[model samples]
Target chain A: MATRDELLACLAQFRDRCNADAQLRPMLADWERTILIRASDLPAEHLLIVRGGQVYLEPAAADGADLTVIAESGLLADLFAGRITPTEPYLNGSLRVLGTEEDIMRLDFISLMIWGE
Target chain B: MRYVVSVSLGSSKRDHEVTAAFLGEDFCIKRQGTDGDLARAEELIRELDGKVDAIGLGGIDVYLYAGGERYALRDGLRLLACAKLTPVVDGSGLKNTLERQAVRYLEEEEKLIGPGTKVLLVSAVDRFGMAEALAAAGCDLVCGDLMFAAGIPYPIRGLEELTRMAKKLLPEMTKMPFHMLYPTGKKQEEKAVTAAKFAQFFDEAAVIAGDFHFIRRYSPPRLDGKIILTNTVTAADVEELRAQGVKWLVTTTPELGGRSFGTNVLEAVMVTLLGKRWDEITAQDYTALLARLQLKPRIERLN
Candidate 1:
């Protein structure tokens, strides 16, 4: 499990990476999605909203998220920190995502863009 | 001279044109990719509807088969409906015949496949004929449809399970946007992440076969001495395979003008040569024509 501070820092770094990537911004230009992240080991929920090709992280949860990612805090931190690729965990069933296939692929693409895939 | 065009939803960087003679008939075959734009593909098809001898719909499949059942993709069907005069085909007709025969030729003539030969097929629903032939040739087959298509890591080991899963998923899966199921446009050009997560599958198999895009996008960087059996590869693709230390590259389609055109383009060629509507052609027609043309798989030893 990751501490609340660790999760926050991880997401902050993720946000910085996305905002700094000029190529990824244009790819997500028209793609706006609300992603809810839950740390299965933590009693906390967070929201990531993308609008106008920018990503904003909220400290609180929101309803009707376009996608939901559920995993242990350590795993979530690792994923956001680019310490590991998502395919292994997602395929092995360690990471669970609730959303349409397009959203899932987009999430993977975003990770691939920020990191190297 | 007959003009045949393939309108694709893939990247335009792979567009190609070649003029060749088949059975004494001159043909100018061309492929144009719309960079994943559906409207552009549809408009291109409409523009070529009455003008060309035949049109091939590439980068998308109008029908997917498994367990002897066929399911039509909504988007693919929409593109097919755009052609009112020229016969439009998605290459499913040839995939069912040509690919199967290609497998048999490789098994019987080349001895590439035999009993207990390990094979990793990226996706089987789109090329079930090849999948079935591989099984019939007694390969230890692993179908990676779920692993590659969906994000699941499960490797299906037999056709029975593949059929069961296809029946459960294809109904809804075929309705989704085609891009979600497979790479298209710029995504097709992107490199696979350098991860060993899926490398075990590649390392375990002596032969990897199926759709070229799937094989290219997900395969591990080094193949050393493995054989790749698939359809459609550009010249650049050939060089890449050679650089990866591949020993053999076998494309189901014959090479034309230094490019292995997709089944869609070749099927369009056959349709024009036969002067028959796409709907009126049968599997026997394709087999007989393939025999007449003596169409053989293009095999090259890269390493």
Candidate 2:
């Protein structure tokens, strides 16, 4: 289980990785969305707003985000770390992701660009 | 300094574009699809012939090889008739020539798919060049074309049968919509979560090979400790496959900006770079260019 600060750091790492990867930059060109991350064990402070080729951490989850992902802190860490896909946990109930197909695909693209197989 | 455009009867959603270097020269390559519209495809080839250096006919096969037998499709004939100034091919040239080399590169040279590997090739009809190459490499191949592509319950055994059947079916298939022949465009866009459907195949094989879209549309569950030997994977697809515990994702084509392409684009690339009329080119020329292009599968290892 990672600390709140560590989780915040993961979000930053994702943004930086996307910026550095030339292959990933093109996929992120049109990826402008508000993603809310809600961990069961942590408070609702981990909010990320993606726009203009960057992801920004917000103080609170936006009123109506383009995508909302809910999971426990440890599972959220696993999702961010590329240890597990959202589909696995989403099916098993460890994670719940709410978004249109496009929204989830956009986030998945970001996740792949950051840590790939 | 050359431009290569593909006139495809496929969908734009799956088509791709890239700018890359080959043999120390730079070129711009694009695949434009009519989404199964024949009139539009004809118009596209006519418009692009003079402007572009080469064109790849996509979605429909111009020719299929089965034990030295060439089965040409009527649809391909129509597309070929529309082109005059630029060299146009259906990527079969590369599929028949370089794909054999690529499979060898993966097994003996690159050692990506090693011997004793149990490979599940989705459909050899679409890529018989690769199918024949994999067979020649002595791989334990399981053909899924019948089950996966044709929606039949049986599995094909060898290259000869794959070629014979494709020769018989491809012409009839061309009469149907492009999406019906192979999943693409709106047909492929699904939100299904049925990993159980293809989990059996993923579990049995060391590598699931063939057209990525065909393999992906079936919704293969996470292939932890396994490999996906295919092409045209996006960044999002990698993320999903990684989460599924895929140890390696060996795309058959080199990618640009996280999007890999099919052989048609590369064949068009070959035409643009060679700067020769299509009829004048020969197998010898393709063999020489294969060494020159230096194009190989874009390998991604997760574990």
Best candidate, TM-score: 1
- Put down candidate 1 lDDT per residue, A3-91, tens digits, no spaces: 98898899889999999988667657657899999999998788888998999999765478999999999999999998976756776
- Per residue, candidate 1 scores C-alpha lDDT tens digits across B219-286 of 88899999999978999999999999999999999999999999999999999988887889999999
Candidate 2: stretches off by over 4 Å: A1-117, B14-16, B163-177, B191-199
Compared with the true structure, the alpha-carbon lDDT of candidate 1 equals: 0.88
RMSD of each: 11.6, 19.0
The numbered model that scores best in lDDT is: 1
Q: TM-score of model 1 relative to the true fold? A: 0.76
Model 2 pairs in collision: A117-B301
Best by DockQ: 1
lDDT of 1 at B163: 89
Chain A of candidate 1 gets a TM-score of: 0.96
Q: Is the docking of candidate 2 incorrect, acceptable, medium or high quality?
A: incorrect
